[model samples]
Target: MRLSSKHVLVLSIASMAGHGAMAGQAESKGFIEDSHLDFMTRNLYWNHDYHSGHNNAQRTADRDRREWGQTFRLDFSSGFTQGLVGFGVDLSGYTVIKLDGGAGHSGQAGVLVPEGNSTAHEASSAGANLKVRVSETELKYGNNLRPYNPVFAPADARLTPATATGFWVVSNELKGLVAEAAHLTAAKDFNSTNLSDDFFAAYAGVASDTVDFLGASYSVTDQLSVSLYGAEYKDIWRQYYGNANYTYPLSDNQSLNFDANLYRTVDEGSSRAGDIDTTAYSLAAAYTWGAHTFKLTYQKIHGDQPFDYLGMGPGTFHDSIYLANSSQLVDFNGPNEKSWGAFYNLDMAAYGVPGLSFGARYIVGRDVDGSRMDADSPYNFYGSERSEDHWERDLEVKYVVQEGSAKGLSVRVRQATHRIGNGASDASADQVRLIVEYPWSIF
Candidate 1:
């Protein structure tokens, strides 16, 4: 049986209300007794080397962009008060200090906010949210949200993660089901200290007044789950997403998994992005034996326009695209693009070296034809290109301290190389990122 978006939303709300009524209010301890405070520090070194000819013409002096910075994030969550309807608050603050990267190397890398020809030495911001709860349903309103849903997820790939100013509802009263709704008005970019930054489309660079979305996920069985979501970007477009995931155990130390994600987007209202109508999807399969796993993925776009999502600022790319083919350096989401990838992962726990891991992936895309795009659309710049292609290769290694005073300390390194055909507009580059993080818990 097929269910429309409206039907799914209604059903989810009805189920949530019914279950919440039956469950009654949850018993809460004193707010101070259940409160928590956490502090984390992240040190990052980012480097991007553009191939000689692929460098941006506007930044002719910057063939290689690099930045080194350290970020301190503090989060506090207060427990609900004892009552039929409980109340709580969440607070978050972030501060970043630049350790390296001057005018010649800081160019648009998004690791730090640029000031004149140089970069900011320090930046900081703070936010708070108020929350209310009854049974298993909760609502939050404020600027400290970092949602991870497919429709409007924020990115944390740089020194700091993006945050949104909005209201959101979550209900988990029903068993094995999660339902959510959100309305976002603005966002704070990772590199900016502004608490209320405008939201823009990644590819079109057009601002959006607001974003609203509804979603639900249900676990059908022990090994199967599915999710559905719908969203509207004010007057720009409407988007719908669906996902299915399954895992089967083949033996005591072996398993197989499959995941699929699909999206349908169409222009709406004013169509500010200009006549966008696209269908994009990805399918992935993986097999694991002992501590080793291998995966393969295929992704495709069936429209004249490329698949796009929310962007935080001028250069801060959001992680709203949940496709399997989106990798470290490229999204592989050109107009009418088809891509395939292979990935491998290794864990050292089986070899008595816990807290160490390695991973690698390679993806290639082809048949990127954008010549048929609308003449006035934001993507018209790509209309001169046809039958383009690109490929990327990535490698990563990470280690975490398992036991001792620095038990939670972690260090990770990632490297990627991307090359695009001449017909494509994207620049070819080699990128490397080194990250070190440690966390502390304070009452």
Candidate 2:
């Protein structure tokens, strides 16, 4: 007697097709195809020194050890049908092998753990996602690892987020306009495959089963766009976001870009037992000339406590780039904490290599107060007992084959160093990562 959401969607599409035919609507149908097979390997080495000692560190609890691992991922995408409305799907998975690690070393954060025995079974997991398309829209149900915005996901590092089982809808019904909505209830961490409801408690206390979000985007012109979004966790919290981006051609060979974002959040119901009210903002500007691109960003958070939100896991890193590194936690875009970053990127194509690039970035955060730590333990929250200032510098280089048998082969390396002052936590460390990928079209 009950119908699944996918089945409902299919029936709706069929009904729409019938109606369109009766109305003499335009009719066209075709099946398009696309796919990517990738093999990615990652290696990380961390050297960390606790600010308040290991027991008092924000991220580490019992001791400090250098850890490393190798991770592999394969992702694929498919195109949908062509007509008044269409449909499609996506699939992806990952595997992690110890390579070199021990009991005290394994499961530090995003790394996978071997199953019953440390030999091999414990370190591998795989999953897939299914999506349906209707016209310029899509509806996805199943496992998904990609999440947008700085306040919603923890993606400042090379590792990915845990997969989430939910339903997401995106639509582009009108030119230059986009809309999105989602209702997710279960999740699995980056290194996990078995779905769990644990995050819901940390996110909204004990009574909620769904996380709902709605958002829209519009492009005002060729180089200007704006967005507004809202998210609500029943009996938990409600948050809103607004952002704008613009790009101007200063000349034939130079351009200027600007971005601004603002967020406001507050508690919602009986589950909103914590003291939390937050507001944050960020502004950024960039200049591009010839082969060089330079950028600068400034951010601030205003709240009694640091800005806090959902995250992938304990070892996840947070940053200000709302796209790749969503800024989250206490003092995030809050009062008492301020941040700034500088970055530069180069396109080798301008010099001759069409598929090579390099980039460097530096970021600093100051005036972070951790006087009020959360009751769930340090790792579960953002604040510590000490006020601290931190800085991070990163460098990366990447290349992709332009043609031939390995045309889609890609290789990249990244290195980063973080330092903390004022004895804040154990997040300060030096890290290096290596990744190689090859995508083969199987259409």
Candidate 3:
């Protein structure tokens, strides 16, 4: 059945109303009596230094952009009204205030703040969702959502999170399995209130109204899970994704883990994205002993176009494209690119500090096909010479209050560096971020 965006919501509400009328009214009181609300405050300090890798005067001049900001986040989720089909609502909003950003660095200093001449000092956004549940299936319509699927996993790396106007349905009736269908109409960028269809377009650069996806995930055992998904950007491209994760205990204090992801994309309909066809894969393995863990990863892209995913924000949380080299500073993804990574993680609890943790990771990518880039691409200077290489290193430490009056307070420090050769897609930069957050329930 075809339905306009407005009709989608109307139909959902109608269904909920019909279901509520049939179910016993007394049971529906739970919707209001079991509601939940929370408020959280977060403070962030970020700094970045950019330099030239090839003496490009333009890229060289932008340096040392710094910004500080604070955010208040509010969320409320209502329990569903008891019925054959239950109804509920979710409300969320965020407000931010810029603390510092003394103009100089291209306003990109605060990647999460909408930039004015320097950077916006304040911004806020709010969203509400109406949801209907029948058995284990749920349908929702709204802006703020967290799907965690391969196609549209919105970014939360910034102060403001990505949001989209859309409708979705999910089912979890089957044990250890979830199935989903989503349609997104428009998206708001991470830092701005403005909605745009072209926000995440890069290849063909054409923006479309609706993006649709269907996916299913299954947890076969306590230590194994798998997912498969397919998506289409109307008039652009169609993509399929697959993922698997597994963990096994090796000994009393040791364990091993494995993860793999694969994606296939092809042009759809009129091929607005210009005959898109691409294949990408990522694989990782990890071993943990006591409070220490080590990991290795490999990633590769096979196609004319680079492996890319949808994101209204600047970037997704971790390896949005399922690539090992998607570091804090750069996603080492380019046409025909291949990358490898190594990482280590440590928990201070082993040494008596229960709420502290540290981590370090390094990724290197090569075989970038700069030659294949057309006018739509970034690096036109180099062609298939494929000599472009880039590497990134990231170090992070974090501490959280485990107990006491200040419990739930967390402090994190992150530093990273991206060094690139001549054919790289992005610039070389050094970044440092300090974030502190104290979350206490306001409900």
Candidate 4:
């Protein structure tokens, strides 16, 4: 089922009114009494290798990219003052030093920003936000906002996390419910030190002045929850999203979970991306028993253009798409595409090894046809492709220190391989990433 923006807004309001009782707010503590300061350091090594010998010959210039970087992040949040309306502030700073990125192996990957055919040696950025709260609602205006919802979310898959300049408001007035609204003007790319970069369409690369979204999530029961969200990409398109999740317990160590997500998009205003009308959805189910979990997912797209979302710059695909089939290397979001995935995860704690885990997933997509796109549409570039297919496989392992001075330190390794067919637009590649992180807190 599809819902319009007005319908979504009205539904959210109705849900809010239905929950009659208000969640009382706690008395505020003086500024600095409840404040927190945190510092974290991360070392990342990433390598991407595009396989040669594909029928497409245009993919030869730079087939391999490898980069290593270290990042230091500092974050501080001040406590609210004691009053009917409380005020607070949040500050964040980040610096990334390139450890390895020679001239031949630098750019195009999201690990580090390139500088004139080479990777930048170092980059840094800082931002702050002001916030006000009343009852169970809070409002924030800042350049360091990291909002995560169905409609919009920043990317943090690389050396640094992306930040946005925006005004955001969140209300938890009613128990088990969260309501949010935001107007974002710009973003800081994950690989760049620039503070404010224009927002663009992920696939079409069409620019937009701003993005506005409203969303709400409500828990109907301890095991069931639902969310609805709507957004407008300022003269580009209007998108709506809905999600439902439920979990059922079988025993002390066994459970079953189901999740479904849906999105509807249509052209609006100038339709800068051109005649977009699409519906994309995914359904996933998982069963967990003791130390192992097994999951299966199915996703589909119904439109002439590929399912796309927001981006900060060239090759900077944000984490805005919450589809189940979106994987480490590819989103599997081609036009008129259908995909399925299988995943498995294991925790070593059940086997006497604490703080260790492993995971693997594989996804395949087929029936990607973009031949129906309008001739003048920005997505026409994909019109030459029909009946394309692709697949990706990923494996991961991670370990964390559980005690002593090294507590809160973690190390992770991930590997992915993706392959595409003749008519597909994506390239076949193998990718590996090694990451180590340590964090500390100071009063």
Candidate 5:
């Protein structure tokens, strides 16, 4: 007999209860006493101009993108019941309305509302999670999840956030160390109604039944930290990751920071992804002094196929520290791509403006070798064999209210220009985004 997801969650939770740490702090405020309700409201506007002309098929097929949406998110959590095996629940939901969107008038790219006969007009979803806690350990099962591991993470750049159905446990029983594990069966994109074995498996021409993972993070000292993680997608691929970071103080208000990330991936079981043998890595260095900060980054992809990853849909965004390239609407993850970037940031607080900041960055990618792509792949694989280069420039400004009724109101503006050095791909575009968010607490 096949066990349902709910059954597996129950059994797993029960089995791990005996090993729960009993050193947790008791909630003297009680279960209902410590409950919380919060709301986050977001307003988004997006504009992009495709400059590939008739040289790219996609550019000729779609028009310039311009749209706006208003989104609302609600969160509710009940404190654990006062007992050895404390139980609790978390609830989250979102409601989004398209202020302005139309077919043939815009290109979505999964950043605004998804294009579904006019971006579905509006979309909404609700999710719930059951949780249990003992000492510093927690076990949870639900539709709303955000996994920070290297393999997967939720996409939150759209009007509605992505969700996944899974069972996970996290423990911090040992000081300075954190351990986590999970088994996920399905996922929902930011703009979809149903959950399925999609995201990562679809790229490989097969459906993944489950994804299991184990991970740990350790802080060796006040200035050094490290992490390791491993995961397997049934009938798909196996992936492993490692990361390290260090900070060194130089003088009273200056410091230097270094970060490195690595990933090793291999095809597993059925080899549906087709003999995937790739190793990818990146390094970043930054120096900070008072209100001024500067950073440099280098990344490389080593394989026949592009460095791939899972996303809500169409790869709207990611939380990976390895592939950051100024959010120029492209991740620069092309096969065998080599990229270098420089960043500059200024904090306005030093100039008497406590709630304002600005930043700018530039990234250049070269050595992209996409020659071994399988033309018959179902998913739209932009794997290119011809060597080419691309560059992007990004600028951002942000501010927040410091006091009074609108104290928590925050606003951010971002602009980017991306162009291919010698190609005619629709990936080249100029984009601008404006976002506003406000949070409120309700007891």
Candidate 6:
């Protein structure tokens, strides 16, 4: 059903009227409501270079660029109705106003697209989303950013793309069970005002014209959970995924967690590979003690090509970078490649500094060969290289104001340095990010 602006208003009024009538009769007349608002600003500095055999020969000497900019974001979510079949709405929106930098500094990076060539700066449309919900489920509509394993709409970068036009149903109707399904069209790549012209375009060896997916998750026990998912992109490929995670207590103050993810994909009708099949997998473990967490992950790609995703992946977290220490880069983990990551986090809040924390991680890639770059596919992060290796280190510190005028205000500082081994094109560089965020609640 198409709902014009007028119809939406009328329906909202009618819903309120019905609730009033019930209230007068002593029936549950009042619905609890809560309002949430969050705002954040970030200052970022980036420097990158493309070298021979890196990113497919996009070398820094030939196309080196550096960028610095600031980004602002606001988010809001509403509460539901009071009754058994409650109704509610949620909103996620943000705008990017370029502070300084342009295409000349073009890694294009994550936020704010250049207006002309790679030198002009332009403001991007504010990404926004609206969602309606029932008892324990939600029907999300409009452009929103989603960050999760698999199909993530990145929002972690200085500026990230916002996916447009999609509907999803998310439910937790049964104990320990969760399910979701969606159809998507149109995407606003981070920092650009225009949606991708290829939003639903299909390619023989590249993107699918449209993307459809369904997923379900179940918790078998407090310490274990499993998930299954399937997806199809017309004329491209069909993909399936399975994931499992379990937690085990090792001692009174420590625990061990294990996680595994696997994917199986096959080219379908009109796909570039006709009937080719591919697989990718990852395993990770973490041990946690009071105030400290140590983690390790091993990833592998076992096909003749890189994994394909809608636009790009790994933007689902506050700190995701392709092939980086923490970001989910599928490239380094692509066909015939193996990678490892080791990281640690410390929550100073547990010791004394409430809302203070620090963390660091190192990631290494090996046995990566890009000689098989998917012809004409820009999706490949590695250029035409026979073998590659690289490592990155990241450090971050954060603090949140606990009390006083600035109570709830949060600040974070992050730094990263990367050095590539032979056959990689990415530049050796350093990055620094500064961010401040706050939230307000209304009831």
Q: Give a tens-digit lDDT track for model 5, residues 347-429.
A: 99999999999999999988777567666543225445367688889999999989998888989999999888764322678
lDDT of 4 by residue, 1-443 (tens): 88654455455444543443323234667678879999999999988888843433434655787888899999999988777667899999888888877457635566775322353688788999998877777778999998888878888878788888988878787788899877788888887777778777888878886888898899999999999998988788888999999999999999999999999999888999999999999999999999999999999999998888988775568887989999988888888999999999999999999999999999999998988888898776565778888899999999999999999999999999999865647779999999999999977
TM-score of each: 0.94, 0.77, 0.87, 0.92, 0.89, 0.77
Highest lDDT: which candidate?
A: 1
TM-score of candidate 6 on Cα atoms, chains taken together: 0.77
Best by TM-score: 1
lDDT value for model 2 = 0.59
Query: Per model, how many backbone clashes are there?
Result: 0, 23, 2, 0, 2, 19
In model 4, the worst 10-residue window by lDDT is 16-25
Could you give the C-alpha RMSD of every candidate to the true structure, in order shown? 3.0, 5.8, 4.3, 3.4, 3.7, 7.1
Full-model lDDT for every candidate:
0.84, 0.59, 0.74, 0.83, 0.73, 0.59
For residue 184, model 2's alpha carbon misses the true position, in angstroms, by: 0.5
After superposing candidate 2, which stretches have Cα over 4 Å from the reference?
Answer: 1-58, 61-89, 102-109, 113-130, 145-161, 200-209, 313-335, 370-387
Off by over 4 Å in 3: 1-29, 53-63, 115-119, 195-199, 202-206, 313-319, 373-385
CA shift of 70, model 2, Å: 4.7
lDDT of 1 by residue, 90-128 (tens): 999888888887456645567765322244578788999
Candidate 3: minimum summed lDDT over ten consecutive residues — where? 17-26
Instruction: Write out the backbone clash pairs for model 5.
Output: 24-135, 370-384
The positional error of residue 101 in candidate 2, measured at the CA in angstroms, is: 2.2
Ranked candidates, highest TM-score first: 1, 4, 5, 3, 2, 6
